[model samples]
Target: MKVIIAVLSAVLLHCTQAMAAAQTGFFIDAPITGIQYVTSSGIEGQTDQGAYQFSDGDVVDFYLGEGPSAFHLASVSAEKWVSPNSMTVTHTRTINMTRLLLAMSDFNKSDNILTVNQAKISQPAVQDFLGELNLIELDTLAQRYDIEIPSVGEAAAHLQSSYQYIKQSLSSDEIVYAPRDTELRDILIKTRNYQGHLCFYNVDEIDNPSYVGPVGSTTYKITNKGIFEYPDNGDRYGSNDGVIASCDVDLRAKRTEEEFHEVSSFEGWSGLFACALKGCTRTNLSGYVVEEYDSGNSYKYRANAMTFNPSTQIVLNKKQGLGQHEKVDGPNNAEFIWFTFASRDVTPLSFEGQWQEKQINKEGVSYRCLDIKQGQVWATPFSDSHCRARNSAGFKNASVEFGDMWWLQSSAKDLYFYHLNIPVAWKDSNQTQHYTTWEYLPVSDSLNNGILYRYQQILDEKDQSLRTSQVSELTKL
Candidate 1:
């Protein structure tokens, strides 16, 4: 059951009357009829992180416009203290409509009661509450026999019923947020005035639950549907020649616990090196390392999955070391708190979990290296270079060679590269172990791929760019 405990805050009075032209055709110019504030503590204990509660106030502003009388809750704002507190809010249009229905002389005071002749405003829910307040309940025979009671004065009857339905529904664990439409009607009935005068809409009591948080807690922002447009027409070539496509994507990472160590240090060890030392900025990475081997112990590899802070690119190393991260792919300098690195160069002949320094023959030159996988050096006596020596004509077919590989060092120096074997898979499955997940999905093409690459020339260099790279879908799991 989801029970919502609404805590009302102490009333802070600051009512002002300001006149402005109506933005819609149905706007009104009613003076300040009445003002009131209400706060609520959300359900659950106070210490529950991210729990939401709120404070709201009513605005009795009325203006003249087209259409029948109606009211709406426009905005809600809350205080910012560490403990929850109250904030101000507005609901003008709905108040005006309810006032019109009541047909009262004054808008703010709850002194007078006007009769509603038409059944248009009296709904089934409203009638149910009125049945409880009828004078028929005082009759002995009616009470003894448990007879049904008819609705009283229409205005009060409907108002009471509307209020009761909202209260009952709100108190139930079965309900989450209040139904915006049903509650809007209650506001309309309470704020109506027949003489075309706007009035204060108030109820002496409301069945808000116990205040759970401080006082005012959560805030809500209101907006109409006409404010934005999502252009999703299966535009495959979303971006090109100044045009952009809509897209979004998510990436995850994994590592082999046995094969990798959270590189403690990589200062002086060597055989081959591939370090990125661009603008050494810190990045948050969340991925895993992997270990692979073969008969000759040679492996080929690469970093496949990715996501990082666009401000700082992600960096990885075969051996653990401390340094700033640089962008390897994605944005120019995207930073990531989530990343994974794997060694794609090297073959393991035999290894033992003992730290050792060793050398491998690459083009007759011995290079120094260390392995966290076995934590032992490669013994030259037991080593055999299985150089299949296939057609090395730039990736034509399958082949192997025990020669030196090359890569760029952080100092922009050319360093011997190695061959490592790393495996990768692409899947966006959300299986949470602790925290809730919210996926920000960007628009995808017909194929449902989150990324789209297009060739374009902003100046004279034609290059590929990711178009419409923004969040387009969201869901909590």
Candidate 2:
């Protein structure tokens, strides 16, 4: 029994040692090659195709050239994919290292890999030139290469531009940079080939019969560049649909927390009574929000509530030639708007042909409609003349101008008529004029043989009021 136990202990020790052995990784920001890397674990070599091998907990320092003349560029913990930005601790240092890397790289190569020009970078003259450059000089160099580095408080914008520049320069569809010990790196390694259809549902509509809401379906694809949604048309108001950012994976919850920005406009009026009202207020609002989503299960994502100040202009009496206006600042105000989405495997369905309004609320309805070949909806049923005639009793000469219609397919294989900033004006019976815009997403229902239109919420221009629900249906005509 002692002999057997000794043999088993030996085997276990061997296995543990093997697990601690060096693992392969890459240096990117275009897969830089021919750079020497030395790890604290004693592993040292010039990167081949940007590849290196190091064990966990190892700190790596990168250099150029050889012998006493070799120049140290940056030092970072061993990672699967290391870039200049990841190696540096401060933004200024990151920019400096990035500029040096760009200056030393051979961009004319056809393979899209950045091969460090050893001959040029090793020269004392070239080193001096790069070392003497200050922030303004670096900015000039970046501009010459058409690369944009955003100002302070614009990290998101800078990252976006970096991603775009890398994508364009490489002409490659997949581009990713994973720093050490990051969830993004783990996610990329685990789901490198993941691609499918994702259906989005509003958080409040998950318990509803059809999971219907403002959000719809989109194709989610994973590339080295991170997850992107195909045909991402910014479905939700003031929110972008493509290229989710700052994603942190939660394996236990099977979801990822992502950051996004929501932009909107604020408007207000100041007056005690109708006779005293003669002022206008408008302000633009933008802020970041974080939301969570599970790739394989139903999850909810919400935009953070935000606050903003409104700019106001007042005119006391227009008829008295008191057209003089004074600008005033209003107190800070806040707003919160959020929705959730559910996803499923994409089922193929073509929405290329024409679909006509068939029924609304179980009542037969007909409308002349044509789906333009260029993916536009041209329907004449809701013209200005029709609107004026229908609401003539309450609003005289009322006009409704329909905005461009963009068709969006949902995960349920139905369609949503997405419209934006549709201007509407009407004069009430008392001749008081009103003007505003409307944004709405009206969804469709699938019958055994026909499509049915259901009730949809319409948001007014200010996003403060709800317009009356408009129900309509359409079928292939």
Candidate 3:
């Protein structure tokens, strides 16, 4: 939740003054009416991590979204804090929609509540607590007893809202950071409303509003369907042009964990990295280091997966050392923990868990599955319903969510270059693990692969500009 707080610092401000004008029809500080959920958890204890406990079928209404961006917690005592004494304190947090979706995802076990732009947010403790506040004990509760309940999906969303109450409250010294997205797999990040530069829209445009919207700006152009159009320096192309800019996507309602189709195609590591020297900075990665290979063997960069390489894959002896994270959406010092209030995690989502829950879907897949014999079959490593690799090449309406954390979409499809969040991981020669929140733009046409180009770019952070050092790539297991 530390990284989430930092992202929210900008997201809260951005959404407040987002493109929504007074005349535009959008909810502003609107209250979520009819807010109520199961009240108490009859079972009480702590998880292995020492978090508060709840019955498997507990009912709770942690808080309600007072508006599109504001939230209120009914009770703080039920939350997970390092200290149980901290629960007595009640507070409201200025969480942005991005982080809110993440919290809701873990709490509700659904990652598609809202669209994540560049990073993934996870608070396992939040999910654990909220998951308990469900209508599980409907027969026990008088309000729900003998009453027809909503379908699992509908109930899932409503029940997930219970996280508001149990969501952790950041202390005075607590700082928030974004959870890492990981490497080699295709990931997506949104450019709209973000301070980052895009193939068509650069930060200079915001600094100097010389031209309005996409057409007036000479820097880049947009298509009828919100796609960007541009001349390529090479043969690469999208939208029948050199490249295409797309939007961030939401996987909120696509599939369920009931052995459905696999949502993500690439099983390899997917993450972001920063290669710039001077003005560049990096910070705040979450979770533990996943020992992909046996600890004694360490890790290796293979032929198929490359985190920093644009085309030619390089081999790394151990994990390369990472510097500070370069600011992605906000200021260069994007990680300043000004917001004292930190959100507690309820329940964190696990990759293996998501994959296990994932069922197969064939609508947008690129590869034909030989695994499917007659009826829908559960996805296995061999028969996985992953998205086609080439289809990721220059996609038209593509979006991605890796490890259920980060989300990205193209700015426009026509542009030749892109600045994106690529996931990277490695162990230092010292045997220390390192995670990179890569936010580099590959040179023109280098990012044309529709399968998983993170996002479009501007002239300043172009692909041909920088040379990324070798780190590690996720090989196909």
Worst 10 residues of 3 by lDDT: 333-342
Give one digit per residue, the lDDT tens place, for model 1 in 120-234: 3244333332222111112322244343322212222333333333233222232112111110000001111111221120111112222111111111111121111112111
Off by over 4 Å in 3: 1-53, 57-60, 64-243, 246-477
TM-score for candidate 3, please give it: 0.17
Per-residue CA lDDT of model 3 for 352-406, tens digit only, reads: 1111111211121122211211121222232334433221223221111121112
Q: What's the CA error at residue 459 for candidate 2, in Å?
A: 52
Best by lDDT: 2
lDDT of each: 0.19, 0.37, 0.22
Error of 2 at 110 (Å): 4.0
Candidate achieving higher TM-score, 1 or 3 = 3
Query: What's each prediction's TM-score?
Result: 0.13, 0.29, 0.17
Q: Which of candidates 1 and 3 is the stronger one according to lDDT?
A: 3
Write model 2 residue lDDT over 1-477, tens digit each, in one string.
Answer: 999999999999987785668787776545678888898778899887678888776667787656544545655556555554444322333444555565666754465466788887667655444433333235544454444444322332333243344334323222121111112111010100011111122222223453222232222333333343333312222113422311212212222334332223212422211112221121111122222344354332322211111110111110000011132112111111221111221123355455554222212233445443334344445321211112112322111212212233132334322212122333334554443222221111111122322223344434333332343444454
Best of the candidates, TM-score: 2
